[model samples]
Target: MSTVNILHMKQGDGEMSYAKNSTIQMRWMNMALPIVKNTIKEMLTIHLTSFEKLESFKIVDIGCGSGPNTLLFMSEIIDTFYNLSNQNNHQSPEISIVLNDLYKNDFNNIFNALPLFYEQLKEKYGHEFSQRCFISVVASSFYERLLPSKSLHFVHSSSSLHWLSQVPENLDNKGHIYMAKDCLPIVFDAYKNQFNKDFYSFLNKRSQEIFPKGKMILTLLGRSIPEPSSNDGCCLWELLAQSLLDMVSQGLVKKEDVDSFNLPFYTPYCDEVKEIVMKENSFDLDKIEVYMCNWDPNDDEDDDNNIFDKKKSGENIVKRIRVVSESMLVTHFGELPLDTVFKIFAERVANHLEMEKTKYTNLTICLKKK
Candidate 1:
């Protein structure tokens, strides 16, 4: 029998183009993704510490955006061996890691960045570093990608799975009601439908490909409190979208186009995730927790503003947020003139968020293969 549990996975559709240019935005993610990676890594460490049976393992990183988290794991593995060597005078256990994500991701960027990470390792541990490291990047989707059965030991992804290739065809974002009550169900349903279809397929495929004792650690944007009617308490995605709409009135974009643009996709609460993962009955629940991400220190807890003022002092914060947010938007809205559109979008989001308090609520899960 297979045991399965869902904590939280998808938060919103992923935007791809964000990290391509701005080092500042990329740096911000460096802080965010690592925190997420460390949290999951601690979970994995705790689980591994109790396992009496140990062997060389293969690590698979899904949706390895920029490969930061993948490298982080590698760093952890190296630390594990180094600590062991210091204690018992033994070499680290041999491990191989593979990085996988959509073909469009900045693999070259990752490759270019590798020298720096490798240098850090070599500087710390000398020649022993290169001999133990095996890293490869695979460009493909989680469902259709090919891998040998029972070949992987650990699988991981962060902030990447929520994006569906496209928004559901039936979604209508321009409805008259703008309150949380009116907006909640439509988006949630779209997200739930997409995840059930794709994520189910992903799990079934993995069930065939991974060994019985392997494990997966996944962290995604989530809602700590269920939003049956509105998007409050959800991740910061909707706030980003509202920022984009602010550009329309400023001659940067058209209102009709903004209305037509729905967030790419996301999934529902933990139970919904469990329904999909449990299909093959091959996974065991280990840990599931929800935490918040991305915060504005100046926000007021009880105010709402519809228009973002791009001209405000410190509004430059949009540039940092824009790295990922605009990247995804440009990928989808490329036809629109970027300079004009982004100017309006930034100004609007700044103004709109001037009075609202928000945080990123995320779901983190760790599962052991049965």
Candidate 2:
């Protein structure tokens, strides 16, 4: 499937909406905040001497998703610039923030929340500071150019970029939605090749848009191991495939349906990401750090309990997965078996978690445009 058509957060604020079930994503955002702050600080320092003469400072959040994280990031950037302006005894530059996502993204949700965002900004940094910042939404895929040449100062993305533009052509991974433990070597090569191509295009476009010495911070699902088939990266999809296969046995879904379905997703190792960045020759890789996050970071209390609560943990994990993937799944498989599939998926994930706590290795990389 083309990602532009299917890859969007669940729209609206319903129970199943991405807005409601995005705690894990929120955590990933929080984890990336330190890198964001440091980059902003460095940029300020590098350009401090010319602060008085500067006109506007442009920052973009690619794949900004819905309201919560986007608003939080905008607020942080505002705060950073506001403080710098005060310290230097110069007026803050007119700030332009562009939120970029696929055309299907619910940009209405973002525009609707602007009144409150402005109100909070005014409360925090006076009405004048709020007036200095301008926000706009750009609906387009990041694989291509979205901004003017050398027009951006800073770029940020979190929990995005793992999605390919589309499923690989002529995929033959039968009965699996993603790379499985039993997948042939060709299946792995197809996924890796697609990622390389998409990522190269992404870097190439961003290279033109970002100014010299501009900074970009990206956080995405990745693996610590060099192998592409690591469980930490592929387990969720494997479990989903199991759930669908279970339905097939009961005649709820066709075998061919399961065989043809493929997820346009890939998680790379930290080294793989660095290698591509170097090969692209557009950005200097400053740092790439991998953090292992629990499947349920909020389940701290359950960690100490003698008996693990599989049902509760399973439900939590399933909700996270469903919020992101449900739209694509329903689009392809129909909505008749959606609930049942997730129910079975929850059980499988819970059982696995009970035996051994699995963690997602998230990669945070900082780059500077040359």
Instruction: Specify the highest-TM-score model's number.
Output: 2
TM agreement with the true structure for every prediction: 0.73, 0.91
> What's the CA error at residue 10 for candidate 1, in Å?
11
What is the C-alpha lDDT profile of model 1 across 43-75, one tens digit per residue? 335644422233444555556666354466457
lDDT winner among the candidates?
Answer: 2
- Regions of model 2 farther than 4 Å from truth: 1-21, 47-49, 301-307
Writing each residue's lDDT as its tens digit, candidate 2 over 1-370 gives 0000001111121112222345877788778887777777776677333666667776666666665867776687678778888999998888777776666667788889989998998898898988987887766677777777876666776776677778888999998899877899999999999989988887898889777777678778898788877889898889999999999999999899889899888899888888899999999999987888878766764466645578888888898888888887777877547889999999999999888888889888888888
Worst 10 residues of 1 by lDDT: 1-10
Give the alpha-carbon lDDT of every model: 0.54, 0.76
Give the residue spans of candidate 1 off by over 4 A.
Answer: 1-55, 67-70, 175-181, 184-187, 228-236, 239-246, 297-317, 335-354
